[model samples]
Each structure stands twice: as structure tokens, then as C-alpha cells.
Target: MLLCDVVTTSASVAATRSRLAKVEAIAGLLRRAGDQVGTVVSYLAGAPAQGRIGAGWRTLVGLSVPPAQEPTLTVAAVDTTLGEVAVTSGKGSAARRTTLLEGLFGAATADEQRFLLRLLTGELRQGALEGVMLDAIAAAGDDTVGKQEVRRAFMLSGRLADTATAALTGGAAALAGFGLTLGRPIRPMLASPGESLAEALAMGECVVEYKLDGARIQVHKDGDDVHVYTRTLREITGAVPELVDLVRALDCRTAVLDGETLALDDGGRPRPFQETMSRFGATVERELPLHPYFFDCVHLDGTDLVDAPLRERNAALHRAVGDALVIPGVLAPTGEQAEQVLADALERGHEGVVVKDLDSAYQAGRRGKAWRKIKPVHTLDLVVLAAEWGHGRRTGYLSNLHLGARDPDGGPPVMVGKTFKGLTDELLAWQTTEFPTHETHRDDWAVHLRPRLVVEIALDGVQVSTRYPGGVALRFARVVRYRPDKQPADADTIDAVRALLPGAEAAGRG
Candidate 1:
């Protein structure tokens, strides 16, 4: 019920590197939150607050200031209390927060400024406090809940404070049964192929589908109403009216489909991912036509097909969406055929291929070998060991991420490179709020973080380097996406890095 309670939980979660544990701690806190202010502060200050949670917090707090300037402003505010003032100007970094803090709080002692900054940054360093909140919820509930159920409720409800109120007044099941909803949008299943066809086959006998590189989207259509959501689950229905019309034209009455939406260039080919996302912006050409290549059907009519096996769901998808809106697939009983499809898809300028296990059901929020993504063997699964603070629009948040690979003898990771590309505005906001929790220590310029987050790094090539610790850095590194399935320990190591070198494999596993 106290601010200290919320602050303590945030401190504990931030101090740890285990995401699962951190999530559990936060979920527990949400269930027990009795103090409205405490619940609000804890959720806003916690780590991994991205996507729905971060957006919802920003909306509620009315922090009109862009995420880039938040750290400076928050830090400076430590000396003074700036009540309800909208940040109007951006002055890079050094001058911005100092000016705002001084103006907002007037003149304050140096120590007072420092103290205020700590609170503004949400680094209260409290411990096991979130669990107390969770206990409060469990105590008030009619029935206990699984951690997964708690997480699902927390995520689906959008705001922890609102959801906590619901849970306390009724029960968790009341919140959990909030009905079919949207959260962070369904992400596409990914695959990493084994070196040989036999090896790929040994992993699993899977149905191989054409992997399109267009924008990953989920279409929700009921009667003539159509809603389009990006992979991150932001509603973009108004942004693509043409696509809405296309969905409305479909014969199906109600359906939820997973697909790729793309923009066609003058040549009539599916445009690049960049071009497709460009249409999502406010200033982009509105008349640009977009088409969807639906791959999986999770719901049709009134039936929820999420529980059905992929083979059955694929059939349902065909019957509901028809072939025109769907990407054609290859029923491969053997890995050799899948290899052929992979080559064909790549030759056609597609990304690669997605290999789905026929018998596997849709496993939401879980990445297993059941759904393997076989991209070109060229890209590296790099870990985000550290990140540098951004400037301008990206200031405060660790916009530039430092990548690392496994060690030669299974030791600590070696730094490979850094990247500032392929980030969305939503992603930037999420990173700004979430990254600080993972900070191991900070310098005047950059923050050294515990090597825990793994990201799939797509690059032009691996080049020889003298600047980085790994002896090589990723050339033109860009984020393919965050690999939530990956653990920091599973991230590519220095041994893997050395193996990527010329003739290293023949010598050993680096």
C-alpha cells in the first residue's frame, strides 16, 4: 500500500537476470496490490515493460515527452518536483533534463535533485515486494491461479492497476475469462535449419511453407468489420483501408487469420519489408494497396481452432480463407523435399521457409522445435550483452545494442558488434523503459548490462575486426527480431564465433 512497497519490488526484479523469475515476482505483486498508487508505480517501473504494458503506462501517466528524453528529464527532476508540466522542447541530452528539472522544480539542493531523479527513474531497488502484491490477490481470490494464467490476465487486461482492481473485487478467473482478446499480437514461428537435409529431417518431419518476408499481420474479421494488427498487436486498421476492403470482400463471415501483408512495387512484386512498414506511418501514401498471404487459421465462424493440430488447422484455413489469400505450402515427408522448397522460396526472393510440425498444436508464447524457422544459414543468433544510450530521438534509452557470441571454451561472451537499425517507434519506447532494469553498471555515456537478452541478428557478413573483443563484428547488423525463445546461455558464443571463421569447423567447434 506504500510507495516503498512498489519501489522495493522493482528493485528486486531489476537486480536479477532471470526473466521467468522476474515475471513471476511481478505477477505475484499484481494479484496482491491493495494500494492503487503502489500498484501503479510498481507496474510502471518494472523491467520488461514493453508492448502493451509500456504503451498503457504512457497513456495513463500522460508523459507527453518522448521516451528518448525521459531519462534526462526524470534524472534531473530528482532535485525538484515538476507538477503536471508538458515537455515542449528537446535539447539533445546534457542541457535538456537540467533545464527542465530546474524550471519545473525551481531551485533545489544538489542532493534533493539526485534523490528526485532516483524516484523518477523508478529505481527504488525494493525486493520481493511484488510477491507481496501477488499474495494480496491470492488471498482475496476464490481460487488460485497458475503463473501462466496470471501472466495471460495481466497482459490481456492492458493495465496492471485496472486488472488488479478487477482481480481483488472478484477473482483472477474473472479477469482471465475476459474473453477472446489481443495482446502483443501473435508472432510468426521461426526456424533454424541443420546443416544437412538428413539433419533437418532428424529434427522433425514437418510441413514446409513458403516463408514470405512481408509484414507479419493478423486479420480479425467479423461480418463486414475488419481489424488488422501488426505482429506487435498495434491496431493499424485505419492505416490500411484497402486491406480492410480486401478482408471485407472475403466470403467468410468471421475469422481470425495469421498472414503476411505486403505492398507491391511498380514491378508488381511484393515490396521490401521497409516499403510495407512505410505504409503504416501517418505520412505514407494511403492509397497504396496491400495484400495478405494468410498461412494459419486460429479461428473460423464461431469455432476457436487454436487447440487443433496444425494439419487440421491448415485444412480449416484452406476451407475458410481459400487459396487466394493464403500462401501455398509443400507437404514434405522428407527433409530433402523441404530443402527443395527452401531453395525455391529463396530463389523467388522470399526470406526462406517455415517448417511446422504437422501434429503440433498452436503453442502461443512458446518456441519449440515443433515450429522451426529455417532461414539462410548465414545469419547469427547474437546476444545483446550491452547497449549504448541514444541521442536525438533515441536519447536515454539504450538504442545501440552491443552483440556478443559464445566463448571458445564455454566462457563469457565476446563482443562482436553494435547496431541501431530496424527499430520501430513502439520498440524504442519499450526499450527506453525496460533496458535500465537490466543495467549492470553505467558510465557517463553507456551502460554495461548483464548478457541475458538474445536477438536474431541479420547481417551482410562477418568481417575481420580489430576493434571488438570477438576479433570480428557483424557487418551491417540489424535486428531480425527479439528471440524470446532464446536464453542468454543459449546465445551464440565465442566458440561459435571462431567456428564461423574460415576452416574453423574442420579444426573443431571453435
Candidate 2:
């Protein structure tokens, strides 16, 4: 198929507000994409099949090319050319990459050029994400495949491209054949925030575990081979050699453990989140050693525990890691007991406690209500929409941040409030250097960004407001830390922010 056809379908998908219409358009395109299923799926979801290729906005915006009078570029041809551009490296590679991009863009039509520019710069604003694309993939199966089956296959495989290909070529039965492997990583389960400890216990018997303020990791061990992956499934085995050695010391031959990893101080307490992240993102040096605490085991001793209940999984975790590394927890605690658990966690310099349903199975990649997190203070993950220039002693820096919450209906983020608090000198210097790289437009006072950076913010509460489109604003907001582990899609929704309103509980239950 021609690149213009895919570009035209993407335009139609972005123009319509109805999700059903978007799904229908994508399903029709998927039916037509015979051998280019991988490329088509990746482009429709606003990403490249080749992944990040060291290309940035600074490199692409400098080239100018004339448009072709006719559409002659094929999808496979573009994919191959991008693969070439990605692999080009070393001396004099920059000039060669620019020449290659110029030739490709010059051959594309005007609309095709727009699509390519957006796709390369990671600014494709189409409303279709992986969730909507999964629905479209099922729709293209002509009722031979179910939506839930496709979702499960996607969660296990950790790749939408592979799941779509399986459903398209081998039907539903082939898609159902996907299972947990020892070395491969599956999507990790997530949690939702509860209003209070009493409310969390109201759900019935539960297991409350301390929520550590650290990076989420999934460790897989098979005999002498060990691999570690982040929550987003990026392998960091080489950077974290200490963790590799630690997992190899376990008793089980093959296992998959889900938990948190952090660096500790001399007093055996957790360090600041920024200090831990500094070590997490480093690749060359080994300055800080990280420690792991196992909470749940998904696979152990050649058996998959994903289908088992939480009680069974915890037992497996204890047998695998023993009492020294197991997270502290209590079973079926009362309201007062749960409060005491939270207090103990805070006293030990931990985040909070996660109340989990005792009989609930591990729902990978889905943020269901089976698990709820309770923290001492309320915090929200919000996007940076814009930043204003600093004043006085902070002159010549990007100081104040305009924050927005994600829209639940797949729309753009809604503005909530702004904050300049909780920023250190290092953070201020880093923002001044990094904010302009994501700049979409600029003015005299502030420079607007692409809403890509996610930051965790601590707030007092929420109040009714007519200034913002969400009808709510944050009270006494301040920054806690920047979340490089999370994406913009992972930000809290506008409705989640409004749930902190004074009378929101009564309105919610009614």
C-alpha cells in the first residue's frame, strides 16, 4: 500500500470525535494492510516501528524539501529507509542521515510530509492509543477473535504489533497460545489510590503491604541466566549488575519476581527518590548499590502463578526469597490495624501501604480496583504544559510550571493549576536546559511544551474553579519529583483530581 493511504486514514481518525468511527477507519485500513501489518500498526499508534533512532526535533526541523506532485512512496519502502537512517553511525554519519531524510521527504506528497514530520518528532496528536487499536484489531478479525482474548495476548506478549499479526494471520486460537516465558517480560500490574484506610478495608479481607518509594522492577532468573526489566519492559541487565547477582543467588532455578528496588543509606533507611533515580538512569558508573525487596512472584519453579490468587502468590514469594527480603505485610487487618500499618510504614520512611484483595488474581497491565494505595499525603502525576521565565534571584531560568491532567476520553490534557515550589537549584538548571527541547511554541513570558514530561505533585486538596476547563483547581500545590519512569498517558485523569473535592464522595456514591 502507498504511504498516502495510511496518512489519509490517520487524518480521518484525528478529525472525528466518535471513537466508533475511529475504530471503523482503523479496522478498514488493517484489512487492507496484507504484509505491512507491523508498520501500519506502529504508525497508526503514533510511533515508529524502528523505535527511537537518535533523531530529535533539533535535527529534523532544519531541513527543507519540495513536495512530490504524485504519490509514489510505498509503506515498505519508507520503513526500509528509516531502518537505514537508524543504523547509520560514527564519523560523517550526520551529513549522510540528513541527505537520506531530504531525499525521502522530497519524494513524499504535502500531506505525507506532514505525517512524516509529526511521526519523526514524536508529536503525532492522533486520538488512537494502544487500547483503541486493540479494539480495531479485533474488529478486523471479522468476529473470529474476541476483544478480551486480544487484550490478554497483548498483555502477555508486551507488543501490540506481534499480537495484531497473530490475530490477523492465525486467528483467535493462535493468539490464545501466548503464555508467560521465563526470560521474556510481561506487563506489570498497577494500583489505584484509595480515599482512606477504612474505605480500603470496606472491600473485605485484604493483604496490606508497604508501598516503597522506589523504581518498579521485574526480575527473571533461569539457572545461570538472569535478566532485569523496568515497568515499561526496557532491559537494563548491564546497568544493574548488582541486581543480576542478587537474583542469581535465589533458590529457584527459573522464576519471575515483581517488586521495588532502591538505594539505602548507612542507617538502613531509604534514600531520597531523586538519589535512587540518579543511579537507575546511569549506565557507565556504579556509584550507588541498589537493594531489592520481593513482594509477589508471578512465576517460580517452572510454574506460572499469574492465574493463582494473591494468597498463593505471596506464599510462593516467601518460599522463593525468604523472610529477609520479603516485604512486611499483615493478613486481613481491621481498620485500626490498617492505620497502624500505614503509621509503621511512614515511621520507617516508606511511602504507604497497598491494600490488595486476598482472592484477586494478578491482572497484568490493567489498573483495576482490586488493589488500592493509601499515602500520608495526596499526590498527583501531572503533565508540564508550559513554563515561565524565572524572576529576581532565579533570573534566566524556566521557573514556574503550568500543569494539566490527562483526559479520560482520549482528548488533550485539561489545565488544572501552576506551581514553582519544591524546586532545587539542580532541578531549575535541568529544566532550563530540557524544557526548550520539547517546545512547541514560545512567547515573551512563557514557552509552551508538547505535554510530554510527567511530574509528581503534592497538593493540599481540590476546589471548584471557573478558570480552568475541568471545573477544578489544585490547592497549595508543590512539586515532589519528576517521574522519568512514566509516560504522558500514565498521568492521572481530570476526574481523579476532582475526586478530592469536599462533597465528591456523596456525589460519587449517589
Candidate 3:
């Protein structure tokens, strides 16, 4: 398939808000992708197959190469070229990389050039994200692979490229082949936000576990060798020797433990989110040790209990690890007991409690109503669009913050409201110095950014508003903290914000 063919499909996907339309258009493209299905799917995923070809926004914009008069670049050829660019590094490699980029962009037509630029800069928002692409992949396979089958494969494998290839080639059998590998990390199951403890208790017969504010870590153990992965599935075993040692000491020979890791203060209270996240450095930092709190054990002594109910998994987890590692929870609790659990968690400086249905199996990569997280205060992970300069005593610092929610349709983040609240003088100095690094342009009032930084914003509620494109605005919004561990893609979407309106039930399912 030609690169222009994929580019045209991407444009069509970006032009519509209808999810079925997006899925069908991409499914049509996948039908014609032939042997280059993996390459073409990765492109539609808003990145090259090799990932990060050493190109930046400025470098992409600086190119003066004219577009090709006709479509000539093939999908396979483009994939191979970017693969080479990903390996182009060392002394004097900048000039060599520039030459390769210039040649590639020089060969692309106008529309193809735009698509390439957006893809390289990680801004190719065509709504072909994992969820939509999963549907598309299922659709491309003659409907032989169901949605749940494809999701299971993708979540366990953690790569859309390989999942797509497997679904298209070997059908359902191939997808089923994707299972828990010893060293490989699967996507962690997440909890949906609940309006209140009372609301969550009414859902089902549940176990309410203490929800801690910490980084999600998945530890896989095979004999003495243990590997640690973040929620994004990036491996960081070497940086967390304590966690590795803890997992290595597990009684079971081989196990996959899903848990949260965070640094704690002297009083045993959880530290700030940034303080805990800062411990995940490239090198080991023993001063700030991260404690792992296991909630679910997918694999224990070769039992393969992932498909088992949470009640069974919790029992297995308790048997595998000591009480210090297993998170605190009450099985089959009354409403008052569940509320007390939430109170105890908050008293320990934890986030809240997750009322989890005990019978729900481990459904990775999807947030169902089986688990509901209820916090005393409502919080949303929003993106920082811009920061305005401060005045008076706060002069010379970026004070007021412009916040935005992620667009579900894969467009730029929509501005919901602005807040200068909850920022200390120290934070002011930090953003004033750090915000410039992500600046795209600067006006007299605020420094426009690339919408990359994710901030956890605590808001009272949202109201209907015509000021923002999303038709809603945050009420009494304040900065909780900067979520350095999260990415812009991980921020809460506009649909979630709309769910927080006065009349809405829950913020989101996932």
C-alpha cells in the first residue's frame, strides 16, 4: 500500500466524530493493507513502527523540502526508512538524521507531508487510538475475532502492531495464544470513579480495598529473576532494587503481582505523589524506598488465576505474600464498614477506597463497574495548556494556569477553565523555570505550550458553559499536584468532564 493511501484514511478518520465511521474507515484501510498490515496500523496509531525517529517539532517544521508532485512512497518503504532513522545515533549523527528526514519528507506529497509531520511530533490525533483501533482490527478480521477477544490479546501483549498482525493472520486462535508471559507485562486493570461510598456500596456484593495514591507497578517473577514494569508497560527493574528483592522473595516460584508502589513518610503516611514518583529514577535511590502493596495476583505457582473471580485471586494473593505487601481490604463489608475503610485510608493520607465486586474476573485494559473508586474530593487529571505570568508578590512567576480536558474525538485538548489556586511560591518558581521547555509560542499574558504536561486538578463540579468548545467549565478548580508519572494521553477526556455535570451519574467507565 502507498503512504498516501494511509494518509487519506487518517484524514477521513480525523474528519468525523462518529466512532462507527472511524472504525469502518480504518477497517477498510486494514482490509487493503496486505502484508504491510503491521506497518500501516502503526502509522494509523500516530507513530512510526520503530518509535521516535530522533525528530522534534522544530526539526519537522524547519524542513524546507517541497512535497512530491505525485504519490510515490510505499508503506513498507516508509516503515523501513523510519526504522533506520531510529538507529541513527552517536557522534555527528544529527546531520545524518537530518539528511534522511529531508529525503523522506521531500518524497511525500503535501497531504502526506502534513500527516508525517503530525505522526513524528506525536500529534496525529485521528481518534484511531487503542480502543477504536481494537474495534477496527476486529472488524477487519471478517468479524471472526470478537471485541473482547481482541482486547484480551492487545492488553496481554501490550502492542497493537503485533495484536493486529495476529488477529489478521491466525484469527481467534492467534489471539488466544496471547497469555501471561514470565517477563512480559500486561496492561493493569483500572477502577472507575464512584460518586460516593454510599453510591459504590449499592453496586454489588463487594470488597472495599484501600486506594493509595501511588504509581502502578506490575512485578513479574520467574525464580530469582524479577522484572518490574510501569502502568505503561515500560520496564524499570534496575531502578527499583527494593521492589525486585521483595518480589524475588515471594514463596511462589513464578508469579505476576499487580500492585502500587510509593514512598512513605516516617509516620507511615503516604508521601506526596511527586515525591513517590521521583523515586523511579534511571538509577536506584535507596534513600526513598518504594513500598509495594499487592492487590491482585494474576499468576501464583502456575495456577493461572487471571480468569478467576477477584475473591479467589485475593485469597491466592494473601497466601503468596505477607500482610505487609497485600493491601488492606474488607471482604463482604456493610455500607458503614465500607465507609469506615474509606475513613481509615484517608486518615493514613491515602486517596480513598475501591469498592470492587468480588466475583469479577481480572478484566485488563478495560474499566467496568466491577470496581468503583470513591474519593472524598473529586479530582481529574487535566492538561496544562498555558500559564500566565503572575502579578504583585507573585511577579516574575507563572501563576495562573490554563487547564484543558482531553478530547475523546482525538482533537486538541479543549480548555475547560483556568486556575491559579493551590500553587505555592515554590511551585510558581518551578513552573516559571520548567514551562519554557515545553513552550510553543508566547504572548504578553501566557506562554502557550504543547499540551504535554498532565496536572491533577481537584474541582467541585462542572457547569454548562458556552465559553469552552466542550460546552462545560470546571467549578472552583484547583491544582492538586503535577502528575509527572502520567502523559498527556493519559489525562481525563472531555466526556469524563461532562459526566461530572450535576445531573450526570459517574465521571467515566475507564
List, residue by residue over 251-350, the lDDT tens digit for candidate 2: 8888999998989999878998877777766778798999988888999998999889999999999999898888877888877788888898899899
Residue 131 error, candidate 1, Å: 15
Worst 10 residues of 2 by lDDT: 52-61
* TM-score: the better of candidates 1 and 2: 2
The all-Cα superposition gives candidate 3 an RMSD in Å to the true structure of: 2.1
1 or 3, which is superior by lDDT? 3
Instruction: List the candidate 1 regions with Cα displacement exceeding 4 Å.
Output: 18-32, 35-143, 151-172, 181-200, 203-205, 266-269, 283-287, 380-456, 459-510
Q: What is candidate 1's lDDT per residue for 99-139, written digit by digit as tens?
A: 55445433333333333334444333333333334433444
Alpha-carbon RMSD, each predicted model: 9.8, 1.6, 2.1
Using Cα atoms with residue i matched to residue i, what is each candidate's TM-score against the true structure? Answer: 0.62, 0.96, 0.96
**C-alpha lDDT of all candidate models, in order:** 0.60, 0.88, 0.88
Could you arrange the candidates by lDDT from highest to lowest? Answer: 2, 3, 1
- Residue 74 C-alpha lDDT in model 1: 31
| Model 1 TM-score, 2 decimals | 0.62
